[model samples]
Target: MIEGALGDLRNGVSRIAHNEKIEELQSEFSGDKPHLQHSKPLHLDPMFYEALDVLHYVEPTCLAAFLKLSQFMHRVEDVPNTKAYMESDRIIKWPPNRW
Candidate 1:
């Protein structure tokens, strides 16, 4: 689980870095305020879809790991308790009074 989580995080970070690189390249080529032609989205880019597939595979695992990590970190940092109020007794409060 730890390995999978790390792998997914690594992949996600790499993807973001790649995207930033692409954006930088585009900006370098097309100066400030590049004119984007309003046209239908290109459907021929299989790479785009392939990236999406990788994201789909990694997203859930990444999210779960992130949540776990966040909780862990929070515990380590001794974050304040923020839980909402709860009813005293679920069975007594939820059921009908007649019962």
Candidate 2:
């Protein structure tokens, strides 16, 4: 899980850095502002999608680990059954909730 998190982090950072360079070049070569040149819906942005994908994977793992750790440390009386919850039919929306 940690490795998956790290991989996602690395991929997100790498994509952002590459896109930043692309934006810089676009701005230098165009009269319009970089943001204007890249005009698209927020949902269409690669970075935004990548972040959502990363959070989708990482959040559940972290939550499960934390719950297990809390149980091990006697911080909580009982850890909820994460496996069952994950297996259930559920639709979890992310940033809209975060926002």
Candidate 3:
């Protein structure tokens, strides 16, 4: 009985953590302005949804997977501009150039 109860608690925590990840992923692709994310609805990408399907099933509380996917999503989102920034060495510039 105690084992069953512990299992329930673990599942609950897992769902909550997964929910947070979903919300985070949603927020990642939400709006034009980063500051406007809160006002927008989720705009998750197909890749995110696909990855979620695989990860959530394997381990609902898989933080490591979430982080990896999150990082990839961030990179994917920034590719166009980020590529230029990287080639320009701005990413490594100390006292980052004034806008």
Cα error, candidate 2, residue 54 (Å): 11
**Once superposed on the true structure, which residue ranges of model 2 sit more than 4 Å away at CA?**
18-20, 25-42, 46-99
lDDT of each: 0.37, 0.39, 0.48
Better candidate by TM-score, 1 or 2: 2
> How do the residues 22-77 of candidate 2 rate in per-residue lDDT, one tens digit apiece?
43443364335222225322322333433434444555343233332223222111
Best candidate according to lDDT:
3
Those runs of model 3 whose alpha carbons end farther than 4 Å from true positions after fitting are: 1-63, 71-78, 93-99
Residue pairs clashing in model 3 are none
> Which is superior by lDDT, 1 or 2?
2
Residue 50, candidate 3: C-alpha displacement in angstroms? 24
Report the C-alpha lDDT of model 1 over 1-97, residue by residue, as the tens digit: 8688667657755864456354444335434431211122233222332333344454635434333333332332232221121222332322212
Residue 5, model 2: Cα distance from true site in angstroms: 1.5
Task: Score candidate 1 by lDDT.
Answer: 0.37
Off by over 4 Å in 1: 1-13, 17-38, 43-45, 61-99
Find the 10 residues in a row with the least total lDDT in model 3. 33-42
lDDT of 3 at 17: 58
Q: lDDT order of candidates, best first?
A: 3, 2, 1
Tell me which residue pairs clash in candidate 1: none
